[model samples]
Target: MSCPHVTAIAAYVKSFHPDWSPAAIKSSIMTTAMPMNNSNQVLKDFAYGAGHVDPLKAINPGLILDLSEDDYVNLLCDIGYETPTVRKISGDNSTCPSLSARSLLKDINYPSIIYQIQLMQPFVANFTRTVTNVGFANSTYKASVMKGSNININVVPQVLSFRSLGEKQSISVNIARGKFSEPTVISSPLIWTDGEHSMRIPIIIDVTQT
Candidate 1:
């Protein structure tokens, strides 16, 4: 069901922006989706990944978290893929970074944030993401979070200013777990609005006993 719907939406977006990459199309659909259901309840990431896709809104997602072939190669490297495997998959002489320089998985410039932490421990997960401007040539966006209890989420440089089309900006999301007694899962959103456009991404935190 969702497969066909998302496929059609992807095609629709592609028809409009023929130069956009698959990652950009996916980002548009995810960021422009409705996070809440018909009953006005926020959807969980596990149940509804990125909520219901809004085809119209997706056509103009304001900002897109576009990724390149190199980004995917880096992601595989960050996930501990061996150099030979990565080269085979990428069909290039790409090499993995040193262990000390490898990036965290959550740092991938996707349209969502999901992190896990050990129960009863203090931890901070920092994610770095870059978004390309596709809306108004001159626009400013402000970041806000609909955070859950027992967690603190902060966005560095809460405001992003874009001077022209295709401009890109990088921001950091720092998530720290607060003191809590029981293991639980929390779902929230990090939203960026530029007066006309509202781009959102889910932030899920799982506090596990293991």
Candidate 2:
């Protein structure tokens, strides 16, 4: 049987430039990272560590996540980098016109970044949320669209809508529910578009989901 433990490590370094792909990520891991063998120990430590914070519920029954990767962890509350949610419409939802999510990101100083999915990938220690953003262009300028998520998901447009324009796509990450076992992998297929001089944003998400 396959193990249920999952660990993910991410690095936004100069070598990666602005984009990445799954095949490339796989190759990278094989060359640079070691395959995890002892999953239970990590999971045990994470739960104990988090439980220490809340003494009252040290043994609270919940999902356990044990993730260890060479790159720095993307644990919440510890990251200087973030995708914060802002209220774009204070008025009524009916009165507030629906704006593209990309519009929100273009206003900031973020660069062109893309992420890929890793199928059957498992991870630990996480939360869940949904967010939206909006932006306006100057005279004769084009406005961008934007949305937000901790991780990007790949599914049919019916389930996971890929990002377009200047907006980021939304993902339903199990990272929040805290599912940890033995090498939990979340799988994300590669996504791309084609055209003359078309910009192919390669996103590599090497995860296992089981």
Model 2 C-alpha lDDT per residue in residues 172-210, reported as the tens digit of each score:
222222333334323222222121111111122223344
Q: On a 0 to 100 scale, what is the lDDT of residue 57 in model 2? A: 17
Evaluated against the true structure, the overall lDDT of model 1 is 0.86
Index of the highest-lDDT prediction: 1
lDDT for 3 in candidate 1 is: 96
Sliding window of 10 residues with minimal summed lDDT for model 2: 133-142
Any runs in candidate 1 off by more than 4 Å, and if so which? 38-43
Residue 170 in candidate 2, Cα distance off native in Å = 2.2
Relative to the true structure, candidate 2 reaches a TM of 0.19
Q: With candidate 2 superimposed using the best TM-score fit, by how many Å does residue 60's alpha carbon deviate from the native?
A: 38
